[model samples]
Target: MENAILLLKHVGYLAVLRDMESFNFSKSLLSKRFEKMIVEEEKKKEGKNEKLLADLCECFVLLNQFCISKELLSIVLPCLLKVGLDKDESEETQKEVEMAFLALSNINEYAIIDKNMYFSEMKEIIQHHQEHNNLTRLAYHSAWEFVIKRFCLDGSLEDVISNELHFAKEAIKELEELMNCVDWKRTKEEREKESQEEKVLLRWLLTLEYFLGSCLLWNEKYSELIRCVVQVYQTAKGNNEEIGSRCIYSLSMAAKNRAMKNEDLLNGGAVNAILKENQLPTMDDVNTQISLKFLISITGRLKGKKKEKMKEEHRKGLKRKMFEKMEEEGYEDVITSFHGIFVLLEGCLYPFISLNVCDYFVNV
Candidate 1:
C-alpha cells in the first residue's frame, strides 16, 4: 500500500510536469498505481508452486480492475505473451493470461489506448501466439475482444483506427481472422459435449455482434458488417438449437438497424421476416415488445422506399413463407402476433393504400 502511494506521487509529478491543467491528477495516479498493484499480485502468484499456472490465468481479472500505466502494461502484457508463446510456461499461466486479456478487454473505457503505443505492438505478439493451436486459439479470441470493444466501439479509438496508419490493415486483418474462426468445429465426440461451453460461445457471439455492429459506424465495411452478422447467425444456428433461434433474432435487429441507416429494402425485409417467424410471444416484456415494434417499423420503412413492384410482391411472399416456417417450427403465437400487427397496420395505419403500394408501408 505504501509503495502504491509512492507510485501515485510519481505519476502526480509527471502529470504536473506535463501541464495537465484540467486533468484529475490524483485519479490518474491512483489508476496507474492500482495497475502496478495488480502486476505485483501477478508476480506473487507466479512465485506460488502449486497453482503458478492457474494464477497467471486468473491475473487479468485482477489486473483489469484498475487503470494501468502504459509502460507497466507493456511489460506485464508481454510477460503473458511469453507465457502464451513459450512451451515451457505452464498451462494454467497461459489460461490466466487469456482470461486477463478477456477481462481487460471488457473495461474498454479505461484501456487508455491513445497513450498505449504498446497496444499495437502487443497485437503482433498475440498474433504469433495464435499460430499454435492451443494458445493461438485463446489469443485469437482475446485479440478480437480487444479490437472490437476498445478500438471499434469507442469513438476516440475508432478515430485512431481510421487514421490510415500502416498497422490499421494488419490489426483489422487479425480481427477478421479471429472473427472467422468461430466456424471451427471440433471432433464429433466433442460436439456433443459442447453444452458446457455454450454460455461462453453465446457470450462471445454477443460480443461479435457488438464488434460487427460497431463496424457499421465506420465507412469502409458496411457490406462486410452484413456478412459478419449473417455468418454469426449461421454459426450460432449450427451450434445450438435454441441459441441459434436467438441469434436469428439478434441478426434481425442488426440487419434492421443497418438497413435503416443505409436505406436498403430487400435485405431489410428478408432479415425482418426471418426473425419475425422465430419470435416468441412469451417475451412479453415492454422492452422486448418495443424492440419488436421498432424492428417492424424499420422493415416497414424499407418496404416504403422500395421502387420495384416485383420486389414488393417478392417481399410479401417472403413474409408469408416466413409465417409458414414459423408455424412449421411450432411458433403459433408468433404467427398470430405477426398477423395481428399486419391487421393493425392495414386498418388504422393504411386503409386506402394497397398492400402492393410502397406508400402503404410508409405509415407503418
Candidate 2:
C-alpha cells in the first residue's frame, strides 16, 4: 500500500507539472488532480510513505520558476504548501516546508506580473495558511509581499494598492495570533529548553523578522514596519546580533522606500526611535552597509524619472537636503561620491534645449 501510494504521488507530481505546461488544462482540472492526490496520499500509513509523499510534492516546486500558465501554476503550487503543512513532523519536515515556500514565492513572483484572474484563489490560499497553520504562515506572509511588490515596484499596479491594503489589514489581524504563541516570547521559563528547540525558536523569529520587513518594504507600511523593528530590538537586543542587524536592515529599507515615495510618515521618527530604543549599531555600521547601498540604488532608480520634472531649485534643495543628512550621519564620503556621480548625469533640460537650438541654427 505504501509503495502504491508513493508511486501515485510521484505520478501526481508529474501530472501537475505537465498540466502547468499544458494548453488544454484549466484551473479546475489541476484542482481536481490536487484533491485526488491529497486523498490518495492520506490513505497511506505514516512514516516512509509520508516522507515519500513530501518528496513528491517538493518536485512540483520547480513550477514556481516557470512563467507558463499561471492559472495552472496557482493550482499546482498550493499542493506543495498543503503537503508541507499536512506532514506533522516538524524536525524532519523542515526541508520540505522550506522548499514548498520557496516554490510558492516563485509562483507569487510570476503572478505579480500576470493578470489578476487568479487572485481570488491565490488570496484564499494565503489567507487559509495565515489562519490555520504556523508552518504555512510564512508562505502566506509572502503572498502579501508579492502584492506589495507588484503594487509598488511596477507602477502599473499602483491602482490596486488600496485593494491590496484591504487584504493586508486582514492578514495582519491573523499574524497577531502568532505573537501570542509561547514560542514567540521565549519567556524565562522556556529558556532552559534544549539547544535544538532553541534553534527552531530562533528560525521562526527570523522568519517573522524577514516576513515583516518584506511586507513593509513591499506595501509601504512604514509605521508598522518600524514597530516590528522596535519589537525585535526590544526582545532580542544585544543577545542576538543577527536578528538585531536584520531589524536595522529592514528599517533602512522601509525608510528608504518612504523617502522615495515622499510618503509622510508620522513624526514618531523611526530612525531616532530605533536608535534610542536599542543600541544596535547605527545605519553607518558595517553590518548594515549593504542595506544602505541597496537603498541608495533603489531610491535613485525610483526618483530618476520623476526628478527630471522638478524645477532646478527644487532638485538642488532636495540634493542639498540629502547631502546634509548623509554628512551629518557620518556617511560624508558616500554622499560626496554620490554628488560626483550626480554632476556627471546629462541634465533633464538638454533634449528640449537641443531641439530648439537646432531649429534656430537651421533657420539661421
Candidate 3:
C-alpha cells in the first residue's frame, strides 16, 4: 500500500495524476478502497483502528492537497470532522484530529466545499472546544481557518457585503466567545509557564483582528464590533508585539472606514485608546506609522460641540507630548534630525489641517 501511494505521489508530481486519464484511473483504484477502509474502521467497536483511521485521514489530506474533487471532498470531510472532533485522549487520536484540521483548512483554501454550508458545524465545533477544552490548539486554529478562509479572505469586499454577512456575523460571534475564554490576567511568569497556551491565544487575537478588520467596513454592527476589537487590541498589546501591531493596524482601518463614511471616527473608546499615552511612538515601525496615521485621521474627523471639545483636549495633549519629547532631546537634536522633526510636526499638524483648524493654530 505504501509503495502504491508513493508511486501515485510521483505521478502527481508529474501533473499526470490530475490529468483526466490518469485521474480517472487513479480515482477508480483508490476511491473505493478508501471508502471500504473508512467503513471497516467505522465498524470496529474499539481497537488499533484509530491509527488506521488517522493514517487514512492523512492520505486523504495529502490527496486533497494536490487536487480535491467534490466526490472526494464529500467522502473525506465527514470522516475528517468525525475523527478531528473526537474527544479521545490518546496521542493517536490527537494526531488524527490535527490531520483532519489540516486537510479541512486546505480544502477550504481550495474552495472545494461551500464554506457557508459548514458555518454552523464549524461554530458548534468551536463552541464545543471553548466549553470543554477538549480539542487541540491546532484543531481550534484549523476550524477558525476554515471559517475565515471561506468567509473572510476568499471573496471580494462587495461579494461579502452582498452575500456573506450572515457568515461574518456568525464567525465574529464565535471569535468573541473564543476570545472571552482567554485569561487576560495571567502574570508574565504565568504566561511564560504556559507559553504554548499564550501562543494559541495570540493566534486567536490576530485572527480576530483580521476577521473584524476585513468585515468591519461592511458590517452593520460597526460600533459594537469595533469596541470588541479595541478590547482585543488592548489585551494583546501587552502580550505580543506582532499581535499588538496587527491590532493597531486593524483599528486604523476601522477608523479610516468610519472617516470614509463621514461618520464620527472617535466613536466608542477608540479615541482614548489610540491617544491613551498621548505619546505616539516615533514612526519607526509599521505599527507606529499606522498608529500615528489613525490618530491623525480620527482627530481630523472630530466634530460637533461635544466632539469638538474632546478634539481640542486631544490636540493639546498630543502637541504637548511631542514638544516635551523634543525639549528632552534639545533644540539642536530636533533640528539636526529632519526626519524626526517632520514626524513630530506631521503628527501634530496633520490633525489641524484635517480639521481645517490650521488657521486657528497659525494665529496662535
Index of the highest-TM-score prediction: 3
- What tens digits encode model 2's per-residue C-alpha lDDT throughout 199-257? 32333343343333333334445355355445654555544445456555555554445
Query: Which order, best to worst by lDDT?
Result: 3, 1, 2
Clashing pairs in 1: 53-92, 53-93, 56-96, 57-95, 57-96, 58-96, 60-100, 130-136
Tell me the tens digit of each residue's lDDT in model 1 across 1-364: 4454345334433332222332342265544554555555555644533233223323333333344456655545545444434443567555545554554444444465553544565455454554544453444455555555665435555544434332224333443554455444665566665442354445445554554345434344434444444454455544544445444544445544542233232343434434443343333233243334444644454455543334666656755654454456455554344555555543555344233322222112
Candidate 1 clash figure, as a count = 8
Question: TM-score of each candidate?
Answer: 0.48, 0.46, 0.49
* Residue 70 error, candidate 3, Å: 6.4
Locate the minimum summed-lDDT window of 10 residues in model 2.
355-364
Give the TM-score ranking, best first.
Answer: 3, 1, 2
Q: What do the candidate models score in CA lDDT, each in turn?
A: 0.45, 0.43, 0.53
| Predicted structure 1: lDDT | 0.45
Compute the lDDT of residue 217 as modeled in candidate 3: 40
